[model samples]
Target: MPEQGMVIRGGAVVTAHEIKEADIWISDGKIVRIAKDTLPKATGTTVFEEVDASGMYLLPGFIAMPTPSLYKRKEGQTYIEVMREWVRSGCTSFVDVLQLEPWMSRPQLEYQQTRHFNSPLDYAWHLGMEAAQLEGRTVARYRELGFSSFHVTIRSPEEISSIQWETLWQLSASKQTIVHLHIQNDASVKQEQRDLIRQLWLDATKYWKVRTVIADSSAAFASREFDPFLHIFRLPAETTDRAVRYMYQRFYDSCPVASPLQEVRIDCRRRWCPPEMLLCLLVRLASTNIAKAIGLYPQKGSLTPGADADIVFLKKENWLTKYDLSTILNFSETHLPTSVMSNGKWMYRNAQFHLSIGMGRRIFDTKPNVYVI
Candidate 1:
């Protein structure tokens, strides 16, 4: 019998496939029950905190993996300030994408320590790789130091052949470490270069048996043609209605056949895409698919029983009613989460953070699981 528990009642729970009215009971930092009917009276064995979630949508908290093309830190800004901005946007998890170099060791450690001591959100690190870093014992050293994933940036065909592909393949295969490829804008435009990129993905997935991802830094790649593979798109810390419009436009341009309503929605009185499509793009692909690509699928991306209780509660009326594109987009982009729960604890409520600074943990995928191809 758990000593502490909470029941969130009467909210429409949004799962990956469907949204249904359900009551969620959380205990010990995990979801314990999702009941369609009202729960029976509790025996005196458990102390329960009850929350009314009527007229709200209870969804998994957003997870962001940001990769800045330039590594310049904003003047006078601290990592905690950056994380607080993300938290205000309903993001619960972050993965710091870094460039690989011996000189970066100190700064990376300092960043990790700062996040550990000042931020109130979970975080991880993904290191960008260089050919020299692929030499003897370097990859092993990263694994020992708790680096979560490796990133590879390809600018030209010569660079691809220059890398010791076989070595990276074997290391990733043996350790199940995720390898992310950033095919730069110029390289992605050429036919021959695109072919090479596809071939590399085949080798990584088929021959090496390693989980791989196509990391899109600028979001412009969403409007380009590329081989079918797992993709992770970067999102700004504090998003806005204009940004949402730009993102939807990119997706519409890239996959017009897939989204047949692009023309009608774009030309509608709203002058932007439907809010549902934006939600699917930003929440489903950005948060859930990225989680799956990084091998943190069911644990971080889902709200099923037994998963971590990282949740965001949003007012249904803000998004479901008839409104202009700017109005609807603001619900998700500009408006803060009405309430947020991390690890079964109330971290944010009534548009304010409730958790203390440094309360969040550093999360990583220590045990890599099999990914469906």
Candidate 2:
């Protein structure tokens, strides 16, 4: 039997379908029961820890799908510290994208080694693919090693040749692997050159016929709809009101996936979105929608019984006001979670971290949906 159990009482539990007041019971690192107010007594003597969640919104923890290499530890900062920052912001799961290196393998052991095992979070790696890595049985090898996705950054049309597109299509059709594409403006390249690359993407999508994600984009392309292809905008760590307006507009109009990494800046300070719309976007759309887009739904994105206990607790008092669109968009940017639980372990509670070194685990899709070409 597991050593600990917990009961969170009197909070509004938010699930994908709806939100309702309930008490949650968790044991052995999984949610065991969910009831209106309290649970029935157990047969054995088990002292479960109790947390009063009255007047709070209990939500599934945020899943951050950050651009590879966006986070680099500042001078003298440790890995645990960096991860703690994520927990502080309510993220319990994240995707770690790494640049392709000659010695890299499907699982990318070197990158995995950097994860703090004692941290109270989970992560998965997506290896960035360049030209050389796309050749031969590379995609097959990645599949064999249990990778369900690959990352590719396109800066020029030359990068998406017929052969490259064919390789990507074959992999997606046969192996169900997703391709995360980052389309960005290259300062070194001329405008016409960048335009040509954008044109290639618009044209290649019709042929690829695979699940592709526009991982990051500029304002010009943020609102453009790419049907059958999901768009996940990467918000600048410090951005303006105009950028926030464009991002939120794109989110509602285009139905793109959102991540916690797209933080906004006001008065020289970085913060999360306004409380009024934060949960709807960050938890519902950003976490749940993105998980489904990547084919890791229900398992990673939900808070139902038997789902992984990756949850975030938010104070109700901080959010109860109605705000206009600009107030909703331009309000402070940091949404600090009151408490965070990942895989049934308390990662952060009452603004304090309860993590050790090397506690975080790797997450992967065990039964990914196969996409037919």
Candidate 3:
């Protein structure tokens, strides 16, 4: 039997490169077509439903960057409430960073899975393993279990030498495994030490050919050498010279911006970037770029044909008066999404939720091809 069909019309559809008025046709949880004219109705077992988007801007639903504690239920916050906040802020998918200690067992993994059973958003897990945990077959073992993304924390320069880069490089060269490096910095660690660690990884990319993402390390934006294999997750603040250099370097092609909505909201309030730039950054960071980074590109981060029908609707009233493309600074406050859909179904609409406890599923179960860009 065919899944229900849907036609979302009367709105401007935002794509990776452009925004234009279009009607979206959906069936079986995937976009079937997008056109300027109304699409034909479904026949047979498929029942077509029409959603009048009227004055809205249809966007690919926001896909949040790696959230370290998203799985841990916070005090005074129910799991559903936690996920509901994401939905309220327009996130339809997210990447969770799961910390796995060397001694943790399979049950620990299973427990993590159960923690998100009530999630209203689709999510994937990036295993957080320590430097010592990278051993013979360890990455391969996790790869078999549907984890291709791994993160490691480096607090010192010596720690970089201890990592089994050969094993990671081999898997990356073979299976497109991604290693996310978080170079920890504080009063204890000198700026020179951090720079050395970044330089070491940058130098390693010359020979090892390992796919690596520098997580939340803004200093990477100032690297003198550009390595195709090295991607940075942090986007320098728009006020900084690094942000200008970042764009001048065209790093957006390979470096996806990683930020949670709260930080984005704060940035907006600060008016650090012009609203137009912020909107573009939001779509790239919150949608397209992160999707590509996690290997869920066109499927999760796009609104084109064959992409998942996950979307968020921004109303016409939210635009700033001066700039046509500018979204108001209080976007999260005054312009939260009017509706959100996941897998072609309405998860949120008109200040109400239509989500189920287990409706959200792990994306890796389908085994998406690893996208190197």
List lDDT for all candidates, in order.
0.60, 0.62, 0.70
Candidate 2: stretches off by over 4 Å:
1-3, 43-48, 66-77, 103-119, 216-225, 229-254, 261-278, 321-334, 366-373
- Pull out the clashing pairs in model 1: none
Q: Residues 215-234, candidate 1, lDDT per residue (tens digit)?
A: 43233233343323333333
* Shift of residue 144 alpha carbon in model 2, Å: 1.8
- Write down the TM-score of every candidate: 0.75, 0.78, 0.86
Find the 10 residues in a row with the least total lDDT in model 2.
Answer: 323-332
What lDDT score is found at residue 54 in candidate 3?
A: 92
Residue 259 lDDT, candidate 2, scale 0-100: 41
lDDT value, residue 80 of candidate 1? 55
Q: Supply the global lDDT for candidate 2.
A: 0.62
lDDT sort, best first: 3, 2, 1
Model 1 segments more than 4 A misplaced: 40-45, 69-78, 104-115, 183-207, 216-282, 327-331, 366-369
Residue-by-residue lDDT tens digits, candidate 3, 1-373:
7667999989888764467789998888999889988445767767778889999888888876534477776543566777787788788888888888766788878777677766767888888877777654888988888888888877877877777777777787677677777777578878888788877876675567766776555444544564643564544334223332344347345543444444453223234545444455556655776677677888888899999899898886674443333333334455688899999989899989898777888888422235533
lDDT of 3: 0.70
Alpha-carbon RMSD, each predicted model: 6.3, 5.0, 3.6
Instruction: Give model 3's TM-score versus the native structure.
Output: 0.86
Pairs of residues at least 3 apart in sequence or in different chains that clash in candidate 3: none
lDDT per residue for candidate 2 within 148-182, as digits (tens), equals: 77777666678777346677667777787776666
